[model samples]
Target chain A: MTGDVIASRDNPRIKRLRRLAHEGGAYRREGQVWVEGDHLCAAALAQGHRPEAVIVTPAGMHWVERWRREGGLAADVPVWTVTDAVMGHISPLESPPSVACLLPLAEGTSVRPDVPTVVLDRLQDPGNVGSILRSAAAFGFAQVIALRATAALWSPKVLRAGMGAHFGLHLVEGADAAAVEALRVPLIATSSHQGAWLHTARLPWPCAWLFGHEGQGVDLRWMARATTTVRIIQPGGQESLNVAAAAAICLHASAVSAFGGL
Target chain B: MTGDVIASRDNPRIKRLRRLAHEGGAYRREGQVWVEGDHLCAAALAQGHRPEAVIVTPAGMHWVERWRREGGLAADVPVWTVTDAVMGHISPLESPPSVACLLPLAEGTSVRPDVPTVVLDRLQDPGNVGSILRSAAAFGFAQVIALRATAALWSPKVLRAGMGAHFGLHLVEGADAAAVEALRVPLIATSSHQGAWLHTARLPWPCAWLFGHEGQGVDLRWMARATTTVRIIQPGGQESLNVAAAAAICLHASAVSAFGGL
Candidate 1:
């Protein structure tokens, strides 16, 4: 059934939605995050995370009503129609989508690391996290371990950056360095300072590709245990690469070395 | 000289800074954008784009005052010391920086035809734009051209993602297909559907690398004019790559092929 359309900015539910959409810790505090646009909404639904409520702009009301008629949103679930201005006020993106839904955090499943893995160390940027996830999915990394201090994997910004790839992967956040050390495969670290040139280096198959913090790079402690540290030879003048770019190249090389058979 | 610490949110200058930070067009309308944190502020000074005014948090004021005494900010520039909460109101990043400065737009420059270049077609995300800029800078690409639909290169989000590479590269935006054709160089196109595998393909040196839309890819019209079309062999499960990831690969491949001294 439809809840009354909310036009007022001060509506408690609307305010809560705004907080969940804009602020950082809302996901942890509320145990929910806003999923926007039709594709991401569909992705969440397909994954069986039912919407607590569906919010739509005036132009989007026809579809929302049709969804109700088709028994798409649960009978008990509420649908709130908001004005475009209010929608923009709550959107994390530049252009607010016509529809944004409230979806519960999908519980983290046991990470069964069957294929090659990626270990992120203190990677700070959400965009980097998202890009890494997309690359990891593309290259068929079995799991992504987000070490403590790395950006939250499920944050709205990261979700948008990942472009629905998050739904398909096994991602663990706040993973300790020791936990990464415990993985079954060899940990191949990437650094600019010391390592064999990646192109000529013989990369091991089915190894864990270790990528470190954006500024600091891989911690020295982990470097001590690295099975091998590889470097992308830079002939150009720039000193180093953006960490996410490095991750993509390293992971792709790993995929290539494995004959991309996994 | 320092101004009365701006205590009210409705102060005209504060409102203007907030607008510039959040709204993209504010830069064009007001001829300025809010550049936050020490690095960007330092970069602006280095590039000779002096700040019109600065607002610093109490903690920020200490270092900023020292910088001002050391001739960091322009002599005539006004400094407004404020609380961290006030700075947070105008910051685009998750955490508010210690200082925020409003800087005017840099003068425009044309893309020189005879240089290794990168062309972005309809790449909509800002972070991707920033990453591509970083890649372009790293791989010795002389210029970066963004199609009209691509995210603005100097937009705060893009600048932040670029980590100051924007200032280092010649960036041109609002480009058209015809304009891209105007550049008299061998255009190398990247595609997943049809092309020689990039690794084995003979790529021309000092060429322009053209990467197309994320979903649709380089337009057919552009592809027809491509001197060579190269594809990355993805032996894994994915159908295609993230455009930025593909761009990095193609650009790096081009660099290697061009300059590897075969």
Candidate 2:
């Protein structure tokens, strides 16, 4: 399934790839997400996903061959070789990776009602959204629901920040309060003030933790749905914690309670 | 101490302030740091630090007067009123803040020997550095030491990311491993692999935790100095945790242990 080498940066496939890399919402329109670097590609493959197409530099051709031999890539996957200049044109990073792939967005999955979950309410930073996803996956939160105003879950920057956590979890983006309300588990909202101290509180093991926007916290509509609200105590008295840091602390607390001492 | 309104962007003071906003190391050369927003300015004043000068938009003049009335700003501090155009020229944010101030970089402080501390080993992201500082301060890590290779501690981005955490902690930047070695308490290194599980370990109350670069773990040189190494158990099996997320978990664990259930 090898294609003719795309020498021109303006090739249709190359232009689409560039759009996918640069536009946060392109995946929603194109039906595929672009992922760069070997680690992400390998992670997708390890999760039983086959790339629709792979773009590689001439120098990366050997690495792709190694992947096929090692069972990290499929032989039938379309492979396109490109010049350094073309690769640069499609890259979103300052230092471009050696290879990249287009993975079809997994069809939207319904949120499982009883499993541990994380609900992101209008989180704007790609880094924060991705970091929360990573923590959710690491701490046994099997599903992530991102509200409509949140940064696009499949954006390249979020993918890089997630560091391969995307493939392992059920990620539902453009979700609304109704989707969150449908969950059977207790909804826990994190606040910097106006709740029980996190450490002393008995966090529900299989619960949905709601983290909100950088400045305005959980939306008032969603806050009305939360069964419990907890605040990470700031003993030193800074106004608030970074949302990603707060998510990590809250998720780890639940993990600790469930696993019983690490 | 009010200066005549400076209407030109080419003014030397305005040019220097713009450089301080854009350049990471400009504070080191300019002998001052730039802070925007009411929260950070109020935090600095609460810490008993005086501003050398306060720059405000015409609309912000009334706010500055209120600050003076409330004693958040000294009556004698130089105040420069700039038009909206000049304010935009000096601002790094897309939405320019109404006001900003110049605070002298306090002379570098030495890491206190026996207090809870955080040693940053070449961590490059300003957001990560600032978030870590917020966590350290919240969890009772009274001091932070950044290795020479780390991001500039007083840089505008770091200052913004810190969210007023900078004023609350003793920060030492451009420090060498020698500075870390002088700490009398046991040094702890956090790794994704190879050590006791962080939750189960009896963490030292006043220990120093070494966090490293985004891609690189702590440098091998400092690993030799670690009295204990701990790993946060990842139940879902992601390869590693984000540095700031890891720091929050580790610091919170130590805080819980020391403070006896916050």
Candidate 3:
């Protein structure tokens, strides 16, 4: 389904793409998430996610072949050749990318219990949220639950930071405490002040790591449900680490401990 | 040395403060580094750094008393009270902070060999550089060397990402490959492919973990000089982890393996 070159900025399809690129919550309304660049598109395809459409510049048509070589970039998927200006109109990045794809957002997503998980509790920064997602995906945490107060999971900033981890993850956005409580795995809440040191703690496998807001630790009400509290040892006597860094260390610990080093 | 209320934005001292806050390279020219908020001020004080001047808003006077309670804030340090408008004029932050301090930048700093250290080789992102700095400090890597191609180490963005780790570090910025070669310890270069898995390696106690540019990775010349090349085992089958996350995982491995779980 090859679409003709779309040059007009006011095209209905272009307007929708603009909203998805700029607005953080637009994907929920549009039912499609826009992923820019080839790496992300390849990653999504690798996870068996077929894009609804692929948008590219005339010069960027080379990427179509590259994407096709990487995964099943289906022949039937709509390929919209657009002008360079139109590419910029639909891109949130400073230097507009050559290719991008619109993938249908999954509906009715639910948490998978008894699996490695990472939960974001009212975490603010998009960079922090996204970085944690990469760590989770890298360390075998297939499910990520973002509490209602957390940054929008599909936002452009977060998607970029996640770097294609989104496709491989079972992400439950806008989840509440009730939904989190439904998880069968033990909840391991991370604390900066008091908790079992991560290095020495006997970390449980298939557990959910609950990371909290930047300013405040885990909510007291949420903290009450935790099976154990863990803290990373700052041997340098510094106060604490950035949340993403802490998440990486903790998640890696579980991966190495439970499965042994690869 | 209590300076009286100065409300004018055009004041010579105010202009210098504005430059330091806004321009990333201004600290080098002015020979002073401006730090904002009580948290950073306390961190500097904890490291026995006496600010040349402490600028505060009229209502922000409470911070001066609070900072004085923290490690040796000093009696003779200049505490300059300014109008709220003047505070806004000098601040680089979105919401103007109540207190900021100007500390003299160190001169003629050199590398310390035979210590747990991190080497940033031409890393582009400020957030990545700063995050690495935090991980290095947290894991007891007391020395950090930023190659000439790396991001400006003392920039405001890097400073914010670093949290308060700058005070605890022996930072050597703007160094060439020659300077890095002078280091006595083993040079541990990190790679995404073709390296020993980090978990199984017998990591040295006081080696330099050389991290490279986010996109290009470690330079070939630098890699050639590496005593050992290490890579983190990504259990989830993801292509790779982010550079900062990789650094955190690698640094923590050295920390825990050598110290035996702190």
Task: Arrange candidates by DockQ, descending.
Answer: 3, 2, 1
The residue pairs in collision within model 3 are none
Each model's fnat?
Answer: 0.33, 0.49, 0.57
Each candidate: how many clashes?
Answer: 1, 0, 0
Residue A188 C-alpha lDDT in model 3: 91
Candidate 1 backbone clash number: 1
Q: Cα miss at B218, model 2 (Å)?
A: 0.6
lDDT of 1 by residue, A1-262 (tens): 3545667888888889888888766787787888787767755555456788888998887766666576655666677888898898888678889998898765654445556788888888787888888788777776888788888887888887777767666777778755775687888998777788676678886788888888888888878879998877565564366777777777777666666332
lDDT per residue for candidate 3 within B1-262, as digits (tens), equals: 4557888999999999999999988998988998988788778887888899899997888888877775467877888888989999998898888898999999888888778889989999888998999899888898999988899888888888888889889999899877787899998988778788887888888899999887889889889988999877778884567788888888888888777644
Task: Rank candidates, lDDT, best first.
Answer: 2, 3, 1
**How much TM-score does chain B earn in each model?**
0.87, 0.96, 0.96
Model 1: lDDT of residue A21? 86
Question: Least lDDT summed over 10 consecutive residues: which range in candidate 1 chain A?
Answer: A106-115
User: What root-mean-square deviation over C-alphas does model 2 reach?
Assistant: 1.6
The weakest ten consecutive residues by lDDT in model 3 chain A span A232-241
The CAPRI class of candidate 1 is: acceptable
True contacts kept of 1: 0.33
